[model samples]
Target: MARYAILVRGINVGTAKRVAMADLRAVLEESGFSAVRTHLNSGNAVGTGNDGLDPAEAGARVEEALAARTGVSARTLVLTAGQLRTIAAGLPYAAEMAAVEKAGSRMMAHVLFADPDPALLAEHDLTAIDPGNVQLGERVVYQWCPNGLLESPDVSGWITKNLHVEVTTRNWNTIAKLADLL
Candidate 1:
């Protein structure tokens, strides 16, 4: 059995797209996942499954089960525990650590469901993204929002608008916690 971290996007944010973590855990467990656990109310789950499902297949199962259980359409990204640890360790903040220390910026990361297109970054006018505030990873993008994500609407919006891919973001602190959970 392999342990996986499942991230559900755009849920439990407001009145719409609400998905209780308990319900999600139950659905996943019922679908053959073992040791299912949830973190917070944002739909982060860690579980061990013996179904031999790949990340993509696990994500599809989670989405299908979620809709069947709660009638909410959610985009789920499934990553092995190792993948989550790699993403946590490979955060692109070392080069900007000093700058962030001086500016007290808040670091954030957006893990994309699919590999981003090579030309997507260049295709989107990135003048709005502050220098050293954005870095692209193997399958995730890191952004250092100096004034928090809520304060940087353009940068947040540009991620989904230009990438044309499903993504779920977590603050650096939360990313570390999730990695530790794995």
Candidate 2:
């Protein structure tokens, strides 16, 4: 069996896209995943699935099941336990970045579900903004907002709004919890 981390975008935020964590776990279990567990209320889950199924394929199955069983439609990204570990390990100066935490939102992982356009670099160069504040991984953009997500000089929204990539940002705290879950 392969353990996978499922990241769902835009759920249980505000009044729309509401998906209860309990329902999410049920949905994944019904979708043929076992050992299903959810972290937090923001649509993050981990489950054990067939080793032969690829992460993307497993994600698609869960996405369909969530909509069919739970009636919640959202972009979902799945990463293997190993891939998740790699992502968590790739954060440059992770401890220092995490230390800047304020309101539990200072550090974040901008998980990219699609390939970002090359032109994105021209719009915002995160590296130039702060020393060791941001590190762009193949699947994620690790950012440390020294002044908090809101006052970090536009470090928060630029990547999430990238026109070419469907990116979802998760707090470093959430990432750490998810790592432990897997």
lDDT of all the models against the reference? 0.78, 0.78
Per-model TM against the reference: 0.85, 0.84
lDDT of 1 by residue, 25-97 (tens): 9878866688888888988888897646788987888889999999999888898888898888887676665
For candidate 1, the C-alpha RMSD (Å) to the true structure equals 3.0
Q: Once model 1 is optimally superposed onto the true structure by TM-score, how far is the C-alpha of residue 95 displaced, in angstroms?
A: 7.5
lDDT, candidate 2, 1-182, per-residue tens: 89988998899989999988888998888777899888888989899998876777767887898899778898888888987898787877656754553534677788877656777766766576556777788788787776777765554366656535677789878888889999
Clashes of each: 0, 0
Q: Return the lDDT, model 2, position 169.
A: 82
Best by TM-score: 1
